[model samples]
Target chain A: MATIGIILFTLVVTLAVMLGKCQKKPLSNACASFAFNTEMNNLQGYLLPQECEGYVAGYVNSGQYHSDFAVAIEAARTYLNTIEADQDGKDLIVLDIDETALSNMPYYVDHHYGVETFNGETWNAWVNNASAPALDAMLSLYTDFRAQNWSFAFITGRSKSQYNKTAQNLYDTGYTGWKTLVLRLPDEENLTADEYKSKHRKRLEEEGYRIKSCLGDQWSDCSGESAGKRTFKLPNPMYYIY
Target chain B: MATIGIILFTLVVTLAVMLGKCQKKPLSNACASFAFNTEMNNLQGYLLPQECEGYVAGYVNSGQYHSDFAVAIEAARTYLNTIEADQDGKDLIVLDIDETALSNMPYYVDHHYGVETFNGETWNAWVNNASAPALDAMLSLYTDFRAQNWSFAFITGRSKSQYNKTAQNLYDTGYTGWKTLVLRLPDEENLTADEYKSKHRKRLEEEGYRIKSCLGDQWSDCSGESAGKRTFKLPNPMYYIY
Candidate 1:
């Protein structure tokens, strides 16, 4: 009976040790996948879904996002300082509109921070309002480059139909002296942002403009053919564009 | 005297309101710049410095880093599934070493989580130990693709002298059936990781290998000519490599 009790005790202790080992093991692929999907879903909208609204809000409110943006802009400035403006006035810097030059934070705040699926009508109305505030760091970059006699071109995903309002907004927000503001035309709406932006950039290069730097919140704005000599990506954990 | 007292009270109230407004103002460019520089300095090593050690430790300990890595690998797998492996066995997937293939966590933990500048002697000793564990997700990826008869080429920045140890470490960690393992040669030591890796990728393409996907923890691993049909970036907030 004593020998039997010793055997049983050993078995019990061994099983307990095995269970503890299992508990301490690293996360399996399934658990990791589930967590990733949850994070991605929260980041699905142009800003953030309701579940992660506080996180995004805190990122902005704590000023970390602004600091990150400043870092990117600083890197761009460092790179741009190395290139002399062409004597032919062909040196150009490309800018994207939304989340790059302008902040749609006011609209997003009103729309559940983009928890709602994008509504074309509401977005168009917001654009027509022409009240978006300048992203201050970008405005400073634009103003500094403009003072240095560098040409600027704004290539945006905003539709050409809203050209009047977009131009009005740019002017009101302290942006001026840009060589061109290229907006998505109705015929080109089917193209991806990358495709459309690349087409416009190729055209700009053909027009004898030497793109010195490209700045955008999305990779689409800074990728593809003729994407400028240097590209700077601003922080936009809100949404992704292919 | 009563009139003077009322005027003074109004001025005091106005002063308090202005002070509140000043306190609520956004971070200035100077403040943002300072914050950015601090963050960059902390990320100067191959891993984080002492100040941000807890942040990185928490990220890894919380398993969020693993989840993010799984997400990237899942994306790559999704893309790869669409491409059929070539009959001639020319289909290839490229992988980066270090944080991508092997977990250096054990070593980093011992070295202040990389607060210390990267020490070649210590790092080489660790490498020669030939005991680095496989990044489990990557091992699963290797096994899965190997079963499908797809080819893999590991292009690592590890020196050629450590080839035997690296090979033994990889094999012991369940990685097998790789078509080639390319390490940095002595003459190629001066080249940037990007330049050296790109050169090898170009050579692979020249050898008629079709690089369907590339995966790495750094942009330098996935950029440059002949990168791949698709590139997936794994999370590595610990450091930045040019």
Candidate 2:
């Protein structure tokens, strides 16, 4: 009976020590990193089927993504209203094409919402088809600015080969009165999105256009030199350009 | 009876029309904006009691905030590992004090997780106490790098008046062997956080320190000229500096 008591006491003490150690080390770095990345990706609407069941039903199908887009557009409108446009009729609004003015959500949806690795062939096919629709909130913002004498310039990462198709889609999607739809030339194809966009913005400035505001779903779009007077980042968790 | 039937049919038609309008306009701009702001604020650990019940039981208390910090620090570690540190001993790692190095979580918890407007009196008192704890992940990173030859520089927005207290707190929190601790001078108080931080970063560069990586909780701390070779943005949604 005394030996049994001793054994029980040792077990209890060992359990207490283990519990104390666990309390001291609440979470391992690896565990925390994994949890954080998963949660962030899920919240941002870029979860994979393996990461979460019903991936489409999580972000795109759910109205949260649309709500976030609306919020961003509203904020942009507020900022734009505060900007005093120059009287020279040279006020330009720089916009990114994919996930900004035009949403390739349909293509992304088919491609596992960016969980699948990007395929140039599939992406080019989608762009060539050119049935992409204008993001509703962005389209609204575009329509409102069109009436206000702001020149709209779409600076996209799309190759110059798809210029006609992209232009047709833009016009079909009610993006009329755009000043210019700039596509990446073959030489510029190797440049990072920031570099490519910045070059065009500098050129636009040299051409006597004052970039009032720049809007895009990626940080690369709103970064780099000549990033406009104000830059608005729309949420895009699908893919990172640079 | 026939007149009553006609009235009922008209009522049904009116109800259907109203339902259709509701479906068409699922959420108003104001409603979406408010909801989006509240949701983002909650997720980022900046929430008011009026926005949600048991506000403190959210983000910070839920361990999500710490997990995010860990994830960011992990990413920084991964990035830092890829950089080939020059042999000159001029390779400096720039750090922001508040949130990045020393967490002001205890003080922020009392201040409703930043729902309360920043109070100079209470904030200074808390700073003068010299009791802020080191953010565990950042402190671990700092300790690991300290064993190596990487020089550390803390460029903070805190006024020079609280320099001694800040230093004392830093020392007490196991942060030693730092190269320099920079505090905002009296004249720099008027400058925005970005401007002030930028000036110091440029000065660091001129002083022959190669800023390899800059880690900060706010965008302002990692932006502007001479923002180091790479900037790692720590998760801080409590308050925006700019």
Candidate 3:
């Protein structure tokens, strides 16, 4: 009788899962975990912006964000030390502008970390103001690379039209002496950031520079053909561009 | 002066997109396009479940879900027509039991679509009830394959212990005449659904079965080595399982 009851109970429970009530109201925990795992594996081609607000907020507030980047940079530093310096053409470090060199925390904070819609007009004024500060961790890494006499190049999604202001902003923010600042030409504006940036890196390689390291916040920064020998990614749960 | 201001404004607007605010909101339009592209490409990786809920909900609520499967099955039918009938060995079509063969719509509707925690006991009881209705679209496909003399196999994530009840449910629900129903054994329960399912597909291949098509709601149902020549997917936005 006991065994029969147990069997019956089990059957009933299974039936409930298959035929029970509407399990609406969202699985918050499961949703969060699933999104995190998917992003970690880069399984999805890209993330939905609406799915990022809370996730990004938590990431920025967490100390883990800084530590993750620090760990990646440390690993990169160790790897770079092993590579023998080039005597002829300089070994290069490809740096993505925007979130890579300058922190956009101010804009993100004001806008609720990407919860708001992106307005081109508002963003352009902010950039032209040149108030954005350098990312301390990346700044330190940049200084270290400079100490080793590596050439720095900025490959950004920014258009060539913003050349003067962007240049002035970079110089004012303490990232001096970059070998090249490759901006997207008007003809290449429609291409993806990955396509545009990869094209520039290939051009640089053709000009006899070996990219020793590539650093950025987006996967597109490190992906594509002619990507660097080493790549370091910073946390940017605030938004996904790719 | 107005013309100059307009030109300046255009430049700034372009620069803003290049250098401005965090573009964080989920682009529903973009998400739809990307998911469509990913599915068309049959990309190896999976989608983030959180990111797919709205899209999936829209798909199911709309008639698009049924139509999509109809198109896929139609394509398979055309392809299957080319295969010569074999007398000694039989061609096989693999189906995932839970969402593919049986519709768990009742449970999802009542439970709010997997928002709540998955209670194994409750789900087991539901399964024991053996009342899940057949998915009409898939049943028609199954019948069509049978008409061609093709064999059918079921590979599910359900534990081996649930074999008897699961079999009963499938039979009662009109998914009869399957060649084999493979369940996850105790030792294999720890593996991800993808890894375990891949193992079974490989084993089936080793046993000399030629898999012509595989159908399921999850990418795991159709990915990895020994995957079928053709794969068909159905929509499920409630939750994702690895």
Global Cα lDDT for candidate 2 = 0.75
Model 3 stretches astray by more than 4 angstroms: A1-31, A34-38, A41-52, B1-242
What TM-score is obtained for chain B in each of the predicted models?
0.80, 0.79, 0.74
Output the TM-score of candidate 3. Answer: 0.47
Model 2 Cα displacement at B203 (Å)?
1.5
lDDT of 2 at B59: 50
- Where's the lowest-lDDT run of ten residues in candidate 2 chain A? A38-47
Candidate 3: docking tier? incorrect
lDDT of 2 by residue, A69-188 (tens): 777787778878777666566899999999999989889878777778679999999999999989999999999977887778999999999999999999999999998999999999
* TM-score-sorted candidate list, best first: 2, 1, 3
**Candidate 3 on A38-116: residue-level lDDT in tens?**
3332223444356566766665665445554554555556667788657663798899987778877888888877667
Error of 1 at B13 (Å): 33
User: What is each predicted model's overall lDDT from 0 to 1?
Assistant: 0.76, 0.75, 0.68
- Candidate 1 stretches with Cα past 4 Å from truth are A1-50, A86-88, B1-50
C-alpha root-mean-square deviation, each candidate = 13.8, 13.0, 18.9
